[model samples]
Target: MRKNVGFHSVRSFSDRRWLLPFLASLLVSFTLFMATIFGLFSSQNVGDSLSLDIVSFTTLDDFENDSIGTDRKKLLDQPAIMQEEAPRIAYLITGTKGDSQRMRRTLQAIYHPRNQYILHLDLEAPPRERIDLTMYVKGDPLFSQVENVRVIAKANLVTYKGPTMIACTLHAISILLKESLRWDWFINLSASDYPLMTQDDILHGLSSLPRNLNFIEHSPISGWKLTQRARPIIVDPGLYLSKKFEVFTTTERRELPTSFKLYTGSAWVMLTRSFLEYCIWGWENLPRILLMYYANFISSPEGYFHTVICNSNEFKNTSISHDLHYISWGYPPKQHPLYLSTKDFNRMVKSGMPFARKFAKGDPVLDKIDRELLGRANGQFTPGGWCNQTSSDEMAEQCSSRGDDSKFLPGPGAERLQQLMKKLMSQEFRNGSCSSLQYDQTKRDWITPKKPA
Candidate 1:
């Protein structure tokens, strides 16, 4: 009986000790479970608050929600929202020293209340000229009222032959994308470039076409160009220097890249906003890689975008293979095209191209273009449907009214441009796209147009 009592007491004590430890474990688990639940709830609440803030911000800044107008406040806002309205163009007009007047003239010639314009006077221009350009944009009653025009206060030093030109263009594109403007196409022009037709004509012609089409002239790099452009190394001093200088070529040459095919063409282009977004954001790796590679290539501007679009599977088919500028190159083409004059006017008119380049400053041909093609008078905005059209005060109040810009009154210019578009979109031109080019792996050269069969 004594042995049984002792054993029973010992067993009872051991059971009590085990029970205490089990209870302590349960309490610790319960405390941790409660903490996790509280943390999840707190996190969800914070996330909900942030989501609401983002939603509210996007709704307020959306341009598609409001009617189109010269709303300066909304236009100046950041993080632009694209609108699904009538097609609008965004223009980047670039110039250097002694080009303020020419830039202004080009601006006025291509001005439309519906479109967006950003003028870039490069770093070479004096501060006084930049200020004068800004004042001209601000002081004009029509420009002030429309508010689509902007002068880039900060300028970039551009070497025409180097990547700096491409940088300036991309910088302008980035600014346009940041603004609250809705545009379908992005067109880059220079102080020497002038419109052959009215903005009404251009807008009208483009309205009928697909917005995805990119008017960039491109061809595979081969022959002498491959040796000169693709193999040579050049340095653009404008990249780091404060002053303008010519791009210098290095003594050594690089072997042509085997990973990607090289392409080169006219530097002037009318690119789609979507394609420009791809180039700028680089969600895909191709554009970024090509940009780095082209950094050292000679005449990077002429080849950079061309190579990018041709290599991109998503954007290659969208290329139209035309630059849309009636540029006349000399026999064997001396570095630049000849300055167009009155002698070229007949050819320019018949060419049906919307724009032409390398025109002499204050040329009589510009006066003829203004009077005959654009119906624009001296120091006046190009007359369009947006202009005030009262017979009583025709000349004075010609462009005073900020009328509806979406409604374009296109004339013969539209017909000519339409014909040109038709020709460009024909089967022959469509068949000559980037995909049609055949690459010979053995010879490491692009075969000429595959001989049709």
Candidate 2:
């Protein structure tokens, strides 16, 4: 009798367990149904307030209008003064191990109160070095006061000639976009790169131009380069591994993509913010699709942004077909350009390029550039209109104090850059079959094809 009673009790508990869940679910359904009848679930009631603010749930005009709104705000705020002054530029200065000092020098050379600077030292740099750099930036009174400089605290492991290089660049762009909205252009430079002109000169030269122009060097991929660069499959260990390693090539070769064309150019570029936004936000699918395609391509940095800009319809016409860099290459150019020295200084200045690259650390030519081109005193910020000019006795001390950032003191460097821009925008340069104008090493400037007589 006792055993039978226990069995009955167990059956009753199991039956009641199912009943509780069933009742709970039924109660939830009833509550939801009551809410629905009250119009709580209706689209009109739920989204009416949101709809009033958002022009449409569909179409991208709203997104474009928001960007235009910012522009309108700028126009309303400054009217004519802001339009005449130089546009704010955002710089991504990247370096690796043993490059902290060089990065500092480059940073000082290009420093301006009106501009934004972000420094990135890849994982290859030691933590102590990174910390020291952060301290240097923070310890400076001018940088702390104006607050335009930032360092990437969490650095990425960038593998040379790999997709990681592209990844690091895109990461920096996103951070800059989030931190500031006033910048008009994004320029990428490595520690090895140094500015030939002051920030004032580059700013003044670019002030009159259309803000949308992208100074990227690009040429269509064809023949040998296509076969060698595009067909290979590569895996950058830096993507998965914590430590740095060389990218390995796979035996499997992929066919050329038929959807979008491939373009190649110099790794460095001076891109407009709007184009970079499209690349980063991916309002359309092309940027993402190409990003995946380039992940395995050799030297992705050289081709990723170039391919994206060329393939994009909205941005294609805006490309200026020049990197605005004075890069010297040997005859039948090797994989890397010759390490620049005093010999290249004359040509670098004549090229009218704003910057040059692959300079050796502690090179004597750098000092000469400082003395002649930048007018930057050793370990001092490049003097600009932003530098306070109180007394000649406190010349170095004057730069320590900030002045009217909007004020620009244009110099001879601006004139040189203007001439280069004129040639780049000329009808003959724009109408060429290929957008890339080759460098005439002998002539020491761009070879703009002569107009047919």
Candidate 3:
């Protein structure tokens, strides 16, 4: 009986020891499982609160109930808004010695509050002449009030046939881009150039057109003259010298380039702001490369922009084959176009060109254009919607006071310009743009149409 009792007590003690350990392990596991579930619920509550806070801060009441997919679809379906107002032009009016007055006249003729103007008198002009021009620009009440006219304080020494002319043009364009953020096109003119239409007419005519068009008369470099132009290397002294000098040729000649084809065109051009930006910024290396290559080429102004535009795929299709200037050349042509006169007035009026070039200083024909086409008198601005008067007495003194520049009063000149633009934008002209290699046969050897006999 004693042995049996001792054995039972030992067995019971061993079983109790194991049973206690098992109970402790079970209790620990249950506590961990409860903690994990509480942690998950706490995290979910915090996430919901953060989402609510973001929604409340942004105040997107309309979109609170919208799904992300629905919002994206709505945004995709919305149409893009476009500007409907008349486009603004940036003008660079350049001149040499004794051209200050002509430059001012041209500026006044083309003046509009909406347009930006930069007048450059080349370094060849005396300091007195430049100062006189600055004084004239500052002294005018209208110019001062509008503050759209600017005179380049530091002028460039420009050789008309050299790359310096192109440099000056790029300089002016850079200034225009910096000063005004809204101009659509850039038009370059010389002191000898004159406007054939009122600013109102021009603004109205340009308002309906695509902003990407660039009016540059270009053709491929070809024939015997191509060898004459391409083979001989020339250096322009105007790049470094303060005084004017002709370009000198080197004895060594170079082979024509195999990489890119060469093109030539009229120096007078009306270019889109976007295209000029591409040239000026040179995001691609083509503009800079061509600029360096043409540094030694004769008549670089006529070819630098021409080559860059035609070679660039981005702008080649955008080129138009016209320079939009009315210039009369003698048959078989001279170094310059014939000096325009009253004899050419009727022809100039009928040509539907907005501008003409190579007019002599104080030409009588300018007065006829001012009187008949522009409706301007008494040395005032060209009459337009900006400043027109109904009174007969006020008609003589119109544009003397400020008026609404946003309004456009297009007239017979607008109709004429529209006709010309229509023809230039037709399918035939577009199909041949930058696609042909016609050689320039006119004097100056640039691509320009001969005056109709």
- Please give, for residues 98-212, the per-residue lDDT of candidate 2 as tens digits: 9999999999999998888999999999999999999999999999999999999999999987999899999989998887557999999999999999888999888877676
lDDT of 3 by residue, 315-389 (tens): 675688899999998898765789899999889889999999879989889999998898878467787888757
Please give the range of 10 consecutive residues that has the lowest summed lDDT in model 2: 73-82
**Model 1: per-residue lDDT, tens digit, 155-213?**
99988688988888899889888875788899999999999999989998887676767
lDDT of 2 at 38: 68
Candidate 3 clash figure, as a count: 0
How far is 145's C-alpha from truth in model 3 (Å)? 1.8
lDDT of 3 at 18: 78
TM-score of the candidate numbered 3?
Answer: 0.77
Report the number of the highest-TM-score candidate: 2
Instruction: Write down the TM-score of every candidate.
Output: 0.80, 0.81, 0.77
For model 2, the stretches where C-alpha displacement exceeds 4 angstroms are 1-49, 52-55, 58-82, 391-393, 433-453
| Model 3 lDDT, full chain set | 0.82
Residue runs of model 1 more than 4 Å from their true location after superposition? 1-84, 392-396, 435-453
